[model samples]
Target: MLFTSIKPMLVASGDEAFDDDDYLFEPKWDGGRILLHKQGERIEAYTRDGQLVTAKFPELKEVAKSIKAYAVILDCEGIVLRGGRPVFDDFAYRGRISLSAKIKQAVLTHPAVFVAFDILLAEKECWNEPLSERKKRLSAIVDTSSSLMATMSVEGKGTILASLMKERNMEGIVAKRKNSKYIQDTVSPDWLKIKHDKTIDVMILGYREEPFSLIIGLNFRTVKNKPVGLVSDGFSQADKDLILSLSKELHTVKEVKTQWIRPELCCRIDYRDRTDTHQLRMTVFRGLLRDKRSEECVWES
Candidate 1:
């Protein structure tokens, strides 16, 4: 319930309405959107759009067991860290590597780090004081230098922090306002993300609402099967409004009688891998594909 995706805008320097100095800028890791919850070793992972993900990441269960808390909810991005750098595609490859000694060897060789950005619940209590305050509690819990998941935090200079957050081979950065809180509605400029350069075309599977997230189900021309993955980030208010307007003309969120227009709009997403089922793994929406079509895309040669 803590993870949400809206559009991103570059924070301008010296804007009176914005506090550039107070904001925390961190590199956005291109990885699977995950929610970590703990209730006395009863831990599990959930996708950004609220799909259960515990079985997919069995290794994490042990670590999740170590942390003893009544209930702690964290907003984090989970990905395999290879050579101190995160390989965003590992989530897709998990199925292939299941139960393989070599798989754990490789993943441990290049482990996955959990970059937690917010502390929604702490000490069996709601840490809803303020985003700035909640982060302090979250930071105190994870030590990036020694945690199994490569947990990290920025200190001394955030500019330096921003630099460390970068993995030249991975995704981009996500900048957030320290003073912000979890707001259910849009127009909150407290967080923004910048991502990598790989883009792909996809179709709208539908939407999932907690904070009104976009769930992009993947499909390409000439291949007919279940989608590969779901995209949960890189959308803004205008973008959501636009989607709502367009989708309403065809379908309603509550109604299945909707008609989704094909090819009128296309989206370019960034991903690190593909599911055997043909879905985008660890992806985000770059924006609408203004000059492309859904049918024009060919992934299966």
Candidate 2:
């Protein structure tokens, strides 16, 4: 069977990690999701959105030799690790470059490794099979010593694994139902991402006029108050109106379309993690904090 375009099964956000006998837990490696389609000596890599990135990562060509099966489709996360932890920033840099010269240089400096978590197709159709069965087949055929390797999974210890990931400052843990079948392109509840929940108090530096967003910043000892980024998510309609109307009175400066504020108002922001450049990742406004002072929102070293 020939595999054309394949979308990886999506995982839904889980609030907290818990232990369950029916679930298998694994570290949710921070990187881009890639589907490896191997047929004979040829192997093609596709992004989660079904974009072919086979030529971009020349290191993936070595994956063909790692698979023991003649034909298979492997769901994997392509990552660049730093000190044994997957760093998305390095992987993103590796994935974005288009020039052959730059890519060749990056391949040497920031080499990527494919961590296969699930087997979609091996020898025959395995997507319909239970996850536990597929995992067994995946371990049997994949050469872990090579550039590609099977992702390690723990049984009935999600909360324990989540705590370990947090201690290592890693991405998070994923809990998957052992009996679940691979459901492509759909966000399945059978798979859940339990990320490390982190929140920070930031000062509202400014506001964007259209579509409505708050420019937030933290008061660093060196850099007083520098704008980190804009956040629009987790705001209600009333919250939007309150900020837009209040911005006119607190207006300090106007640059382009952004209305700068006095940096008096402070609010809390929920974020997944900080990027390599120190920008917040996956930010959500948790509402205004009236008791806290803007000066108190310091970015601690």
Candidate 3:
């Protein structure tokens, strides 16, 4: 069956992990989402956004041999693992190469692995089937190997799995309802992402008025204040007003688009992780810190 015209199911965010007898929890691999289609020997891969990435990740060409079925479509995440954990920056770098020689060399140096989580088709339509049955079928057909592996899952213990994956610095865990049918091209509530809670304290550097965002930086005693990233989320109207009042009192003439502040105010930030350039990813302003001093918000490592 051709899955090129279809999109992978999307997930909604969950606040915290919990135990649920009706849901299955699986590790959320830190990598690009891909859907693979196998028709006899011909194998094709597409991104969640419908971008054809088969030519980019040449190592995935062997996926057909790892599957027992002659025709099947699988939903997976393509990741490059190091030390048994996914290094997302390395996987992202592999996606950006254009030259054929570099691509071949990267395949040898840093190969991609597809972790199958769900099966859409196996000689018949399986999208309408319950997730639990589809998972069973996926495990039966997909061989676990270095290049292609079926995703491992734990039933009714999302909290435990989430904690373990967090300790390993893995992305997070996804909680899928066991009886939920696969819904294509939609962010279904049947699936939820329970991410690890990570936070940091940073000094507020400035603010931009148009989009209403804060320019945050990490204070350092030995070095100059480092521009970590911008934070525009998780702010209430009251929080915005407080920042506006503070900016007026601490405003400086050294402004360049952003209204520069005294850099004395400190606040706690929630983030997913750091990007390749060391900037915070998916930052959210938790709240202002009254007890902590700006100087104390120094870089940890």
Number of the top candidate by lDDT? 2
Could you give the candidate ranking by lDDT, starting with the highest?
2, 3, 1
Which runs of model 3 end up more than 4 angstroms from their true locations? 1-3, 199-214, 217-228, 231-253, 261-269, 273-301
**Which pairs clash (backbone N, Cα, C closer than 3 Å) in model 2?**
none
Q: Kindly list the per-residue Cα lDDT of model 1 for residues 128-154, writing each as its tens digit.
A: 466668777776654453323323434
| lDDT-superior candidate, 1 or 3 | 3
Report backbone clashes per prediction.
14, 0, 0
The C-alpha stretches of model 1 lying farther than 4 A from their native spots are 1-19, 65-68, 95-112, 124-127, 143-167, 184-187, 196-301
- What is the lDDT of every predicted structure here? 0.55, 0.87, 0.86
lDDT of 1 at 186: 42
Q: Candidate 1 or 2, higher TM-score?
A: 2
Which residue pairs show collisions in model 3? Answer: none
Per-model TM against the reference: 0.51, 0.76, 0.76
Which 10-residue window of candidate 3 scores lowest in summed lDDT? 218-227
What shift in Å separates residue 262 of candidate 3 from its native position after superposition? Answer: 11
lDDT of 3 by residue, 1-301 (tens): 4846577789998878999999999999988788999888888888887887778888766777899998899999888887888767567778888789999999988789999999999988899999999999998999877799998999999989998998987778999999999889899999998778578899898899778899898864456568889998898999999889877888885665788888888999988867655588789999999778877887643
Error of 3 at 165 (Å): 1.0
Candidate 2 residue lDDT tens string, 17-81: 89999999999998989999999988998898878888888887788888999999999999988
